[model samples]
Target: MRKRYLITFGIVLFILVIDQVIKFWIKTSFAFDDPSVPLIGEWLQLNFVENQGMAFGTQLGGGMWGKLTLSIFRVVMIGAIIYYILKQIKKPDVKLEFLIVSAMVLAGAAGNLFDSMFYDFIFRDYFDPCISYNQVEGSGIFSECSYFGYTEMVEVRHRGFLFGNVVDMFQFNVIWPSWVPWLGGGQVFPAIWNVADFAISCGMILVLLRQKIYFPKEKTSKE
Candidate 1:
């Protein structure tokens, strides 16, 4: 049990730290909606964008209440997953893989939760300022900088508390054939995401890909 706890918590902390580092870099170094800088010659790019709603930059509803609801939902889901993992870990034959996946999920959720809950008070927009508000402040580590041609142009209106925006910065410029459905000759997987989002997706995808192994069926006595 001690070993399991250490491994699980370690994974979560490692992911959370690295995810925050990347997000902090993005928030302070680049301008908003700036042209995607090619990391792998158009294949992979770093495009900074803030998601105000769900993963992959999908919006749920408009206004503060909508965002509040989304944040609450995330909190509940994270709590449920953590509770389930804790209970399962107490079992003698708990699956290590499942535990790792759960840890990853928990880390990802917590990472995004941090942004949703406190980023507004910790960081300010460098390229774009709040159009509606006259002024705002940032107290984060990289809250001020001049790298990558970044200028403290406009401070975005502070959303406050559980209304902060999720920072995302990875973009894959996937080229597809002209015959390929709606993606014809356009970038595939265009949704810009962050390290935390990637971690969550990876964990969930692994579970789906190996569901049979993680969840085995019991044999009947008659059989």
Candidate 2:
């Protein structure tokens, strides 16, 4: 069954769980706009930030409505990609690398989608800690200062849509060299991403570096 569709589905779901767990921790323990919670100094952190955009808060789009639309669009895209991956895996000349890469992509997308869809709506009640200035430091991106936190600290699943931003809490940065271009001499890596994002990056890079292993060069019509 290692070569079956179940393997791909199982792996993808596993990665998605890890991604959401980490995000849930960050959202529950910290506030947005926080650069670092000092997990291990400047090297490691549990920073909290939000994005109405794509993964890692990179691909920004329109307003809240726009983000909601994109979230729905992602479900459709991931569904299509999963279908393609399973179909390819069943082919006689299926490439293992391609199948895995597709799985990686689907997993990362699902992980982030969970937050954008139900996280803020239902899980919001859970993330909120003590409802006071001493506990949460009176900080939340939410507009209401009074209900900034849970009054009695409950964990009720909210009904309907919330459309809150996704949690991204990983920070890795590098100072660009002055001799480079556009962003030269600038600081980077404020992006707080999850493990699924890392998995997607690694999978894509591996596939690109070994392109011939997946799609070998085709002979010309002259051949």
Candidate 3:
């Protein structure tokens, strides 16, 4: 039991650290118009982008309210997953693989949740060229600022807690062929995602692939 606990903690910690490190590096070093850095030829590249809502750049709509609701939902889900893991850990028949995957999912959720809770406050100096604003003193209202060159931009106004955008950098540079119906010359996977998103996806996929092993069917009395 102690070994299982340690393994779960280690996996979650390792994933969280790697995910946050990659996100922080990309957020601080990359600019909006920077060219993508190819990792494996032109297939995979590092392209910086941010999303205000869910994974794969999906928006929940309703603007600020939507962001708040999504963040709250993530918190609730994380808590529930933790509870489930704890209960399962005490069960003699619980599979270790299940626990491992669950930990990865938890870590991924936490990594993104951390960004939503604090990135805006921490990365205020990372300016966005699209909307220039002059923040009103003591009030959160931001007035438009005069446009100059993109180089001479002011720090972005903070968006309060649970309102920061999630940083995404990795992208698959595959584009659909022009002959493809209704999907010509578009990226096969248009979404730019980060390490946290990758971890969550991999964990869920593994669980699905090995569901029977992780969850064995109980034999009936007659059988």
Best by lDDT: 3
lDDT score of residue 16 within candidate 3: 90
lDDT of 3 by residue, 48-98 (tens): 888776777776754556678898998999999889989999999898889
- Measured against the true structure, the TM-scores of the candidates, in listed sequence, are 0.84, 0.73, 0.87
lDDT digits (tens) for residues 37-118 of candidate 2: 6666565666666655577676444544556677788789888987888678778777765777878888988777777778
lDDT of 1 by residue, 131-158 (tens): 2222233412123334478655434333
* RMSD to the hidden true structure, all candidates: 6.4, 6.7, 4.1
Error of 2 at 83 (Å): 0.8
Candidates arranged by TM-score, highest first:
3, 1, 2
lDDT on C-alpha atoms for all candidate structures: 0.79, 0.66, 0.81
Q: Count the backbone clashes (under 3 Å) in each candidate.
A: 3, 0, 0
Worst 10 residues of 3 by lDDT: 132-141
**Most accurate candidate by TM-score:** 3
